[model samples]
Target: MRSIWAATAMTVLLAAGAAACDSSSAGPAPAGGLAGSTASSSPSATPDLEAGEELARGLDVPWGLAFLPGGDALIAERDSGRILRLRPGGGTPEQVRTVPGVAARGEGGLLGIAVSPTFSSDNLVYAYLTADADNRIIRFRLDGGDPETVFDGIASAGFHNGGRIAFGPDGMLYAGTGDAGETSTSQDPASPNGKILRLTPEGKPAPGNPTTGSPVYSLGHRNVQGLAWDADGRLFATEFGQNELDEVNLIQPGRNYGWPEVEGDGDTAGGRYTGPLVTWPVREASPSGLAISGGTAYIAALRGERLWTLPLNGDTAGEPAARLQDRYGRLRTVQVAPDGALWLTTSNTDGRGDIREGDDRILRFPAR
Candidate 1:
């Protein structure tokens, strides 16, 4: 689906974003490596496989997951564009509402979900999906009412429509978008595709953006599928790379991550694009959704069919370890619940991989 370089930069950026922002503002941060660039050599500890438990099943190609404050989970179906709500204790999923204007061709459809931080008051939910002409992000009121479109007008294609949304610590909305299957768009600052976008609750550009209040935070990404923020307010993202390098990158406002120019950690022709903090071979990690907590970042792998654990020390990401490899086929999305547990979804019905009947399910793991 994505190039190896995109994957690596995605992971590194996600960790950086979480480690660099403030809990109250979600504003941009100074560009710098975490902890003076002293790379930590500690490897990820072996995960206790028995700790992960399946929480729900019968999901049709679930792609995105968002947790409500009351411990319920919202799940998105890629093909049907239906959003389902699952209560704790595991019962039948209730279809909340179907998203409108979704183009479910190739790797596009209902992709990412994020609830407003002030959900108790706002009752707002945001989603990123592929539209008929492009990829778009929209916010809807989820208080048992009709869905409303808040923002739209992103680029899309048959593949590489980076679709992930998250509310920053500042209560603003941040979206990760793909380059719409085109390599050059990643480097085009004018294009909304292949960039991390910062927007207010009403879909306007957040205050203090890179440009004079422009929505594009940073450019030069192929397909970004995950976003997260740590306790210190830093931001991180996961991206799918070209054939060779998949990336995890630390995201800085207005910084460029060389996508078509460079793959993995290397210099590019169009100036020095930032390299990934952590790079993985494409075969090992076609990482998607990412979650940061307890000084670690969790990445869900699609082609690799595993969960990768990366220990974090400030902005630097330590070596990563693969967990549950081959145990589940094509892990798609990962989210950190409000109670600090990790919720993951499987993507067996996406048509690109093996569709195991009842293989697409939700699993929860205790965050260590």
Candidate 2:
């Protein structure tokens, strides 16, 4: 069956207007904030969305998407292990490179892609993939060379293999990993699984990390596939819950986000676990890729098949509004293009949903 609902952005925006105005629905304040400061009382305004156009069609389980300096995007296919490049205007995508030894099993495969922030000088493209032995991050150049392993040895499984990596404003590489179905790993400081790891470009633990010589930046995430930094340089992540709540968390270094121990705003009787800024029923928001623009976060939903927009004021987030509901089947990744357009990918061909004429496609929309 089709995953997303077929509704226009304006229609959903109008439908959610009432709910968006209600400050009570903004959900919990999450954990950490400036002392004695109150959350913004005014609701966040709805995004001005324009008609979307398909950028490319017929992708096979496209997972990771990154943009180069020239306005072209490099996308990764989860099962195919191929990297394809396409421009803003529609055309057949070109295969730039194919990663070798990629184990495309279950949720494992080639996942996230990132261009080195210093790409002008380094010409490096990074990828997070499930290799034969483990889930690892590797960097390679489009010009052709053996991919160099930046980091490795996270347990790999058919499911819960979180694979998203991005370079933080601090110039440190941040990776989100899953527990690989091993729940205990979420809370284990020694294990890289179920944690957001901070590492130097060469893959050593970043300086001033939460723990001395440890890459674990935050613990207790089930599966984190989306990472973005706001204008203020605060980190935000999208996490998948186990049949309960899906989360958009305001991430802080060294903070513990209750994963196996709790889901959503659960039983934080003590101040040990940080709560999510926003939570949605799992069916409504299997949120994956996230991008923030104009003080708003645009999240791509998988099972929910919609794009969720939440306004950000300071550290507090306003109520979330769903746009383009069911218009696309199974959204996977969303990124802000260099020209400020929002680029999205579909996951209908990723072993789920009803495939359409353009089963797996890349879409472009105006940035708000």
Candidate 3:
């Protein structure tokens, strides 16, 4: 059950968000604004629940968007294995660096990126990518210096290769990995695949992990694509179900999520795993990058082609409301920017969707 305070906060947030969405200008954006870019969508158009503008377009399968201190965004391109930096004031993107040895196969490639917690001082950036033999993470200087592998040897197949990384409130790095199409790996305690892992910046296991000498924070995840945390430090992750269901789970340390044995809410008793906070049919939500803001969880949906806002009350989630349904094709990520806005990335150019001329864009909602 939700607390009174949480419910009240949720109400205020929804009202404010709705007001902002409705008060947008109906006039079209400037004619020359989208010139020289592959931008088919109108930046002036207001989606159902949000008014958004295209920040950048014509990207090559942009997987992750990490905002830097000065408001520059570093976007990771999956197939091209490049990290492009886009400044705030509308200049052409600069290719900051290309990841070495990325295997850009199906469902794998240069994936998630996280700027170092001390990026202002250290200039380090971390990336998770599929290499020749396995999935691995490399930390390197932002100035294109040599890299060092922090962790490696996770299974990387053609599909189900999970790749989402974030820094938790404790400043430790957390990663969500997939089962790599190997269901058994979800239950394998020793396998790095299909688990949420906590580690130090250097790739060693964090000190207070659920198990000593191991980075495995939780197991039994099939294909976790997103991770976020609420104000109470409660962790949440979005997952891909094999065929029928998609899930947003409240992640608890050491808890099993019942990968092959259970899908959605199981009626069978005594399962050795936790049920997801909410579930969706596969067609409605192939859940991806998630963000928590003002007591609501904003989830990016791929197959659903919308954004889902799930109100949060403590550990429980309210009914989800779909936003921008099919207005933008295949939303890939939802990130809360430093300026209290939401950054959305489209996945239309990723070969899985029908693309307009100006596809694969970064969109921004000034207020959420």
Candidate 4:
């Protein structure tokens, strides 16, 4: 039965518009902005809930978020480059003063955050951001201390600078990067952009990396904005495809995923690239900031304005089912909190979208 099901699935994907090289095929593009970008949908009926209890509103374009050890949350604002500490009860946000050298530009800034595994003792906070010349990763003590540039020299562009970071179960730092809007760079081995990078905590290359002394873990990614590991330690990632295909992939070290070459799943003989476990039309899914828990990968959709739940069995990813569709204006980030609930942030303030005053909010949902 499993073999028959796999064969049927393969046949269906082959018939769909999968490859980028197919002249007759065109992928889904976002409505008003770039080819794969999306616009805001109409607002849904507001739910009747207690104010300031489940959600903490009044955030100014919050981008990345990390949970502190003491049940507090630290969030970063994209435009202002400020990191705010959100207290449990949620009054005024306390600003952390030590962040330095953030180049806030198109889809760039302090983009992703992760607390150190030893943060209780080390007080270290790591951020992936765009600098004046390039996209880099930096680590700093949370108590208003000078930052140390751990890894430098990743690619950067006005868009597609893929700035999501997380500490993997191996105690190594993993970063997702974009192709910097250059199609060719996604397939290039030497370029850091359009790749998944693995590095040591101090910014050195991990010992078991596929490339010797190089941080490239996986290649041929357009813009990877989310990374998560399952309970079995299998890695999964969400990527923004160029025009039509947005992908959820079971990431493997040193594997090439077809980007400009092959968009989704079709002919593998075209190259040695791996196919996505699941693909969605780009208009329906510009996936970012994914979190995995209880055998499901929860993905935050930017242009799609939805939360996608993809069931996972080991390293294999099933079809993505949409949740909260058209309910949130523009969902930017989704994370699993320490308390096991899913926390989501809206991207209504992203400048490209229709800005609803006070529309940007952090919402928490019970984990299913």
Candidate 5:
């Protein structure tokens, strides 16, 4: 019961005091004090799924989810800085642009969306936002115009603005920050706020980072939303837990995921953290966006609406199976769609769940 749980009153999970304790209560979560072990929401042996369709709907708060190489996919609307482009068989999603000065407030706007693994010819595309003051990472081109600041100040708070951004597997560009609530800026390494950055795609600093020109790479985190890359590349992350566990790390670089002072797997009696390839129970799992194909690594549960698959053995991890629990409720972000299916997003409209009425969708499972 020690390892941090009262840090300035447990914040982050889209802060604002956990979105005002997530409206009223998302229930069931509290097993924190973890650092490992807790993958058995029952029903093992894998196989389980009979439906999944939505494709794309009204989409109000849909935050980040890149995947384009013809199959089309590039969504982001965390409060409407817009950036649609779903396409694939469903048609009608196409908005294609809109980023200018996005400051959309609370849990910040236009979060995560990457697609520039050369992006077919550098037509680029990258964003991780919350502007009006800070928390940046831009790069655009998909039809629109303007947007070229590769990295900016960071530290956007309405509640810990750590927006997730991905593009790893050596291609660099991995962001994941938050500490805007200032918990000592996650141990300030000259402050990049909570940290987990690695650039180069013009953002500079990426060449086996660990301080050379600095892009920090790894250093105590508190709100890293997700960044997958497994299949031997090993580098998973999905942190955001303060009042009782909620993590899923596996990152390496300058290592030191002990935030404010450690959350789930700490106390060798004195300081030193990094223990999570597992942990949930911050009201079930406020864990957001995270995906890995075939060998499993799903995890997209906002207050545990479900989609926690885990089964990756190699760098270690196995025993987790929750798949679509509350059906299609919260669960924001999860990709791997280029035909190989498995795309999810539906944050119940973001004011916090039960919205329905085309509330927020983009479901579609069946990942080989």
Candidate 6:
């Protein structure tokens, strides 16, 4: 086994031939990874965990992972504006659709994707992307059709274009938007950026929102990229902190999460703001995508180069455990497959990390 620091130091020198292996080839991964409780700030060696099977390779900045009705995966590329579909068993991914009007810039491009809950009837697929004018959510049919704009007017920038969308249990669309490098938008009620927007399938504000006739469900968020619901219908979101702490917040309608006012675990300003349930140093957890399975919340980390697991204890989150530390370069998106396996994607080719051969690949892990 190699030390995480050693692996990280040698990341740039990884052999091109090693990364050139196709998805059909099998490779041995580093063993004896490290684990620790993020809340306690302690790390220790854990058992030799399985490295999982590589599903596809040679991807270009894969960011989103959503499943079709038949269990096929639809992946969104952050820079290419292309959607690729892969089988559950692992093989070469086939291009399905190429989204138009994408303005790929710094950290901005095609981001998150979702399939309609009633795909059998409507066959609609939803996507959150950075368009030429703004960040927007669009829906199109996988069969064939021009993509229709479901919602628009969210701000976009080189960075902080929050682009994750999903459907809740109540059949409403939920989108997380970023502040677009403007600190004031996080606290502003009129701006859609830096807030969670809830809408109907037709792009109207859902009923029972915090404010009547407003799509804003929650406000005061910095840059939210991950959103998931627990078995009990609790919404958990992952937010990018400024320079110090990153956060995992339990979301509620119309709630204000301290942004410019505070970063993590700050003074709630006499209960006016809600604090995060868990916080980690930005280096340890630049968390991106989140998925909850069997009461455990799995977070995909980028700069940390690991997966963070947090157990759910009713309304509270337990200590987080790190997995695959430095085994892969940088993790971007994580999703629980329809058959209960964990699917993860690497972002080494995303321009910020060392580009290894065959980087930006997808891996499939066993069920939890």
Tens digits of per-residue lDDT for model 1, 110-181: 988888888898888888888887777777777555556667778777888888888898888899998887
Best by lDDT: 2
Q: What is the lDDT of residue 108 in candidate 4?
A: 89
Write one digit per residue (lDDT tens) for candidate 6, span 91-183: 446566778888999999999999999999999999999988899999998877788998999989999999989899989999999999998
Could you tell me how far off, in angstroms, the CA of residue 126 lies in candidate 4 after the best superposition? Answer: 0.5
- How far does residue 37 in candidate 5 sit from its true spot (Å)? 50
What is candidate 5's lDDT per residue for 221-247, written digit by digit as tens? Answer: 888888888767888998888899888
Residue pairs clashing, model 5: 29-284, 162-177
lDDT per residue, candidate 2, 1-368, as tens digits?
Answer: 12232232234334443221122212111111111221111113222455576666666788999999987888898987878777666554656677887999999999999989999888999999999999999998777777899999999999999999999999999999999999999999999999999999889999999899999999999999999999899999999999889999999999999889999889875989999999999999899999988788999999999999999987899999999899888999998887677888999888878788756788877544
The TM-score of predicted model 6 comes to 0.87
Rank list by lDDT: 2, 6, 3, 1, 4, 5
State the weakest 10-residue window (summed lDDT) of model 2: 27-36
TM-score of 4: 0.83
lDDT of 1: 0.77
Off by over 4 Å in 2: 1-48
Give lDDT for model 2: 0.83
Q: State residue 362's C-alpha deviation in candidate 3, in Å.
A: 0.5
Clashes of 5: 2
